[model samples]
Target: MAIGYLGPEGTFTHAAARELRPGADLVALTTQAQAIALVEDGSIEGAVVPVDNTVNGVVLPTWDALLGTTASRIVADTLVPVTFNAYALTGDVVPEVVVSHPHALAQCARYVSSLGVPSRAASSTAEACASLAPGEVAIAAPVCAELYPVATIATKVEDGAGAITQFGVVSRDDVRPTTDRWTTVFAALPERNAPGSLAALLTPLASLGCNLENIVARPLRGSVDYVFLLFVTDLDQDREASALDSLRAQCSGLSVLGRLAAAKHSRPDGASGIPARLAPVRS
Candidate 1:
């Protein structure tokens, strides 16, 4: 089956896609949202989209897309180390301009500042490398050097060490059973302007033994209310049913995105170590 990724190939998402679905034909798309939308529309079997990063925090566009999706859910997750490398046309070339995705440029802010060159944003790091002009350097994945006609001018150009980006593999189909610890993700629209609304919505999770790993808020469109995206783990099947019932009674709406194996660090063997399984939707 074909899988979509935020790409032009040679991107971190591309790497994650390869790690998640080795030997599957990869379709490179321009944006993470586009990749996810394709899966929602059944144009592709799945798509790997960036969800979070160690250096950059949550990927906002991805969260927005998830909130909008109906048929698609994040079936699995993977992490890709953000190893930013500076590439140019020639090995000895000095760059007048630096180009990369905004997130990549921001992660390598200190390194880019040292180059004394203006940094421009591109659609993707790999795209920047593919479209590199004379006297321009692109901060991109190390794999770009092999895919594009560019030489690595500097390695590990990111400001920090061990920066990693988390990608969610979205699919419409229910995932096969797996044995790994699972986390259920969903978005909740709590009652607007109600006193103790947010707290009331989340208290049941703690009481039911589910650990809330991460919570992010996005503005609910055309309203003052916010949609809370929750990543909850330590779930017991028996307890979760009760938690869901309590959550439904508290919130105006809940979109159970997926129940996925907890993400682990990317291994040296290029495995994410996460497995996939689906839980019944409680929306």
Candidate 2:
């Protein structure tokens, strides 16, 4: 099966893909949209993409893409720890521009500042490596330092190796969870953003005893609307319909983004075999 992931080999996303669903034929694609598009179009059997990171919060456009992808269902979830490197031609001139994804640049902001290197964004981390010219560095996984002759310095530059990003196993077919998991997505805005309206909006979940894990409140840029995300403990058959009702009533002004499955997650460690947990923050 061809599986899609945020790539060039050696990227943290690729690392997560290897750990979660190893030996699947890997599809190196550009944006998260592009990756999901492949699945929608039947170009790939499944795809893995980053949903969140500890230090940086959400991956932005990816959030929108996940909501927008057609008939895509996240079958599984896993965490991948990121370790970035300053990759250039071995013993060659230092690079002025480092081609990488915007998320990679933010994850390694301090490194970029230390090296005084500017960055470029690509569809995928792997695609960025493919586009790099000679003498330019790429702040990506050393495994991603392809195009032959590129070198990597300063491995694991992210401040939080403890930091982890969430990825979804996407396919149109329903794949039941193999273990405990949770599902999160934006529901709706029942009303325009107003004084204390959002909190007043979510009072129903508490009433239903539907323990919410996190709530993301974002104002749609240049609009009076808002997007509210509820990261609740995974629901089962008895609770699914009622939970959907609660979501609809609570955020009547909001549009219905699919209530996809999410699993409880933690950061992975080599010895303990459990990923460290971040303090309860809005996912």
* Model 1 Cα lDDT, one tens digit per residue, 163-264: 778888888976622644677777888866578989998898888878888899888779888888888876656655676787888878887776656464
Q: How do all models score by TM-score?
A: 0.87, 0.76
The prediction achieving the highest TM-score against the true structure is 1
Model 1 residue 192 lDDT score: 66
The C-alpha RMSD of each candidate to the native structure, in angstroms, is 8.3, 5.8
Supply the global lDDT for candidate 1.
0.82
Give the Cα lDDT of each candidate. Answer: 0.82, 0.66
Give the number of the best model, judged by lDDT: 1
List the lowest-lDDT window of 10 residues for candidate 1: 266-275
List runs of model 1 lying over 4 Å from the truth. Answer: 264-283
